[model samples]
Every structure is written in structure tokens, then in C-alpha cells.
Target: MLIQTLAAAATTAAPQNKFGFVEALQAGGFIAYATVSILGIMSFGSFYILFTKFFEQQKIMRQGRDVGTSFWKAPSLRDGANKMDKNSAWRQLVDDGLAAEDQHGKMTDSMEAHDWLHGSLARSEASINARLAGGLPFLATVGATSPFIGLFGTVVGIYRALIAIGLAGSASIDKVAGPVGEALIMTALGLLVAVPAVLAYNWLQARNKRIAENLNGFSTDILANINSKGAVRPAAIAPAKSAAPAAAAPIKK
Candidate 1:
């Protein structure tokens, strides 16, 4: 009988959770839902850009490695370009350089062949850099604006709390807890959405800078090779030579 009475008393003493996430959202109504939806979209877009750009940068880096091995070893510019992946940025630069070289002869008497070729390759480099930079602005936007977006929800939540207090004639816990919780959720959500976006933006931007540097150096090398008519080539990256085994010791000691 004592155990049964204790169980009943324990059950009756436990308080219900009226100030939880669901309750807060329920109190905030349309404004809370809108904030969550917008944040969700921003988070999704940020991750998508991060993953896609990372893979793209990695592909270019791998292609950069292959340039010294497979590319410069070929007999001519045409042969070297054919050795690279056709869709690679390096291949595009080579094709543009070759095309420019072909057109340099057709320019008017006043235009120098070297200047025209240089200008063509520079334009090609700029275009590739621009293409690599395509989706970065969305990341920047999310990073910069997500906090304010969340703040808007917070402001609305606070306003609701104030209204509830006024209607109830006192600032009691029950009257204010839901809206206050909602406001905090908005602030936290804003931070969560913004941090990852800012991190991704910085990381991808750094990768792009590295790629651009590599592209510039490669472009310069290509121009020199083309101008010197296959006489110039960058150092080739040869595979490591295995150490030969020592001759077996004489059988007799």
C-alpha cells in the first residue's frame, strides 16, 4: 500500500514540459515556421556549394600534378595537350594557346604575334578563374545575411512575448516562457546557419587562390614553350627509381 501510494504521489508531482521546442514553435506560429524554412534553405545551399567546389578544386589539383609528368614529356604542344584530360582547365588553356598561335599570323601588319598570343591566353585564364568562382557569392550571401535573418525572427518572438505579458496583466513565467524560448531558438539557429557558411566561404576562397596561382605559372610556362617553338620545357616529374639489391655475398666466408 505504501509503495502504491508513493508511485501515485511521484506521478502527480512531475511537471509537464510546456516550454519546449515544439511549444515555442507553436506559440511563435507563422513567424517561427518562416525563420526555420529560410534557415533550412540557406544551410542546404551552403553545404551543396562546399562539396561541389571542393571536388572541383581537387580535380584541378590532380591535373596540376599530371602536367609535369605526362604533358611536358610529349614531342610537341599538340601532343602534350592530347596527353592531358580533354575537359581539364590545363587542356583548355593549351587549346586556346594553340588557336591563338594559329591566328597570330593572320593579324594586321602593326599587331605583334607575341602580344596577340599573350592577350588570348590571358583572356582564357581569366575565363577559367571566373568559372571557378561561380557559386561563391551564394556562400558569401548566406554567411553575411543569415544572422540578420535569424534576428528578425528573434525580434518577432520578443514582440510576441511582450504582447502576452500585457494581455495577462503580469510577467509570470507561464505567460513569457514560450515566446522567450522561441527567441533564443531563433538566435541559436541563426548562429548555427551562419558559422558553417562563413567557414566554407573562407576555405573555398583559399583553394581558388591556390588554383589561380598554379594557373598563372602554367600559363607563363606555356607561353614560353610556344614562343620558343618546342625548345623550352618545364622540368619533368619522373617516377622514383627503386634501389637495386646488393650482389649476394660470396658463398665461402
Candidate 2:
């Protein structure tokens, strides 16, 4: 008699074992449906930003390399400056140096040369920063909001499970497990979407900063070359042809 009863209980438990969070979702609970929807959108948005940012940063680095090499090779600012595309900041700085030389004859002070170089450098810095910052807003949005979206889904799932228990007039694993399990899936999904976005954002930001430093170094080199050509004042001045100008003044006394 004991064996027969145990066998009957096992047969009844088999159907409950087959139930899962997916099966619970199919059972028409608002909580499960909403959780799935939010997770889908968050995941898609995160991936889109990741790939887009990757391409943008890669392109900028390539352009930087090209610009760096060309800036050094030009015979004079005017000659090589024209070879660079407008997007190349290093080339623009070289052009600025040439223009300053043409206007001022020579750079008497380092401060004056830097002032002439400032326009091109500032413009390049702004543009590079703008490109690097692309897609970061979306990454930030996902990181900040994905968890809340998932929590919203979880809460709904739990509430639905509680209601199901009340309506069925039972508090048993068969009725409660599926819904609770479904709710927790949302939290997991939220973390899944958020972790990568946060990490990618930090990584990209660091790379861009390094690029900025490289560009800054290049700018200094370009200016130094321009100064070398004719910008520096000679170290020694020939002594005034005879006595001081005052002594050479008419001998009124």
C-alpha cells in the first residue's frame, strides 16, 4: 500500500517539474510579458551603441596616424600644409605656423607662436572630443536605467504570483515557483545588459584621452620645427658699430 501511494504522488509531481519561467510567461501574466519587453529593448540599444562607438574610435585613430606622419614629412608648413585634408588637425597647426611666420617675419617669443597655434589646436581638440564622446550618452542611459526596468518587471512578476496564490486558494510550489522564477529572470537580464555598457564606456573614454595626448605631442613638435627655421633670435648680437648710440649722438656738449 505504501509503494502504490508513493508512485501515485510521483506521477502527479511530473507535470509541475515541467513548468518553467518560459512556460509561466506563456500563461498570460502581465509581469512576465513586460519584463521580456524591457529586456529586449535594453539589450538591443546597448549592442547598437557598442558597435557604433567601436567604429568611430577606430576611424579617429587611423586618421590620427595619417595626420601625424604627414605633418612631419612636409618640407615647409605651406608645402605640406596643403597636402592635409581639412580634418587633419596636425596639418592645420603646421599651416598656422607658416601663416604666423609670413605675417610676423619671425616668432620672437614662444608665447606668440603658441597663440598662433592655439586656434588650430583648440579646434582639433574640440572635434576629437566630440567624436570620442559619441554613443556614450546611450551607454550611460542603459547603465542607469536597465536595472530599474528589470526591477519593475521583477516586482510585477512577484505581485502576479502572489495574486495567483490568492485566487487559487493555495500556497504551494506548484502554483508559486514558476512566476517567482520568471520575475528573477528580469533582474539577471538587466545586469547582463548593464555590465558591458559600463565597461565599454570606460574603455573608450580612456582610449580617446590617450589619443588627445598624442595629438598634443604632435602639435608641440610641429611648432618646434617652425621655430627652428627662422623664428629663433640669434644668441649673439654684433656689438654696436662703435660707441653706444648715446655716445655717437652729436657732440652738442
Candidate 3:
């Protein structure tokens, strides 16, 4: 019944009685109609980028959490590196630190430990930002460009309306309203496309910032663990003194 009613309404709008996207578009006045087409394309691409990036960032955050938890539980730095989830960005940082050093290498103290942590965290954070920022440029473009596209349609529509007025030699409500109304449709469509894109851009930026903080927290935790283990040296400290006895004696004199 609803479909039939809609069909009837569509028929009243057109001479041949058909309901379709093209037909509805034709009724939209030329400028308004063109605005719809341009905005439609931009909105499609913007949404695709927005959703895909959202899920991708979420997955990265989850994996980062897993990596941080696993690193804290491991017995040693090497062990932590091995135990961490491979997919986590933090895990990659640990891997980089370990790989940069030799088998006998160790973090030593708070400063070196901090350096390693900082480097690891910085690298991962940079990467996460890059990923999070992905496709945002397109959204920015859509937001900026859509209004102009609409304005162009409106300008064209107004031009046609003016021409019609000249040709008829009289200003009739029907003649003026139809073309002018159609042109204003383009501007409305442009706003429809731009507003959502701007909102999405702001939202994604906040999300990326939160994710960066999480990654930084993980870096600090890894460094703290390294500092804790650094304090536990050999009980005697004998080897260094014995190996440099002559040097020790000169200092004692």
C-alpha cells in the first residue's frame, strides 16, 4: 500500500508517472541536482575512509594493550621482548631496542633505560599517528571543496532563472521560484556533505590523541621495569676490583 501511494505521488510529479533517482533529481532544479551528485560522491569516499580507519585504530590499541601487559610479566628484557605480542606497536619498539644491542647488552640504569624507552615509545607513537591520520586529507578536502561545488551549481541555476525572466518579459512566481529554488538546493547539499566531514575529522583527531597517550604509558612501564632490574647487580662486586688491583692500589696511595 505504501509503495503504491509513493508510486502515485511520483506519478503526480512527472508526466509519465515514474519514481526513480534520476526523476527525483530532475525535479531538484539543475543546480540542486548537480550539487547532489557531487556531494554524493564525496560523502561515499569520506565514510569509507572514516569507518575503515576507526576499526584499524581500535585494533592497534587492543594489540598495544596486550603487548604492555605481557612485557610487564616477563622475567627479563629479552624475555619480555620475546613474550610481547608481535602485532603490538610497543612490542616492535622492544624488538628494536633489543636488536640495536649485542647479546651481552643491558639497559644499565635509569638514564639509559629511559633513553631506550623514549626511543621505543617515540617510534611507535609516530607510526600510530601516521596510521590514525591516514585518509584524513581526503575528508578535509571534501569539507573544504563541497561548499564551492554547491555554490557553482547555485550560480548556474540563478543564471538560468534570470534568462527565463528576460525571455518571458514578466516576473511570474512560478517562473522565478522553480529555478531559484532548484539552485538553492545545491547549497543545501554542499552543507550536508561538509558538516559531517568536519565533525568526523574532529572526532578522529581526539581519538588519535587518546591512543598516543596509551602508547606512551606503555613505554613508561617498560622503562620502569628495566630500572627495577638494573638495581640488582652481583653481590660481591669483586671482579672489577681484582681485575684492576694495580690501579686500585695507586688510588689508595
Best by TM-score: 1
Model 2 root-mean-square deviation: 10.8
Model 1 scores worst on lDDT over the 10 consecutive residues at: 232-241
Q: What C-alpha lDDT values do all the predictions have?
A: 0.90, 0.69, 0.69
Instruction: List clashing residue pairs in candidate 1.
Output: none
Q: Give candidate 2's whole-model lDDT.
A: 0.69
TM-score of each: 0.88, 0.68, 0.68
CA shift of 91, model 2, Å: 4.8
Q: Which stretches of candidate 3 lie over 4 Å from their true place?
A: 1-35, 67-69, 81-85, 102-121, 224-253
Clashing pairs in 2: none
Candidate 3 per-residue lDDT, tens place, 20-77, comes to 4454357555545557877899999889988997897888777766663555555566
Candidate 2 per-residue lDDT over residues 1-253, each given as its tens digit? 9999999999987665445667767753675677678778877887887888787777657877775456445555576667777756455555655666576545565557556655555665567577668778888888888888888877877887899899899988878777777678777888888888788778877887887787676666666656677343212221235655555556676
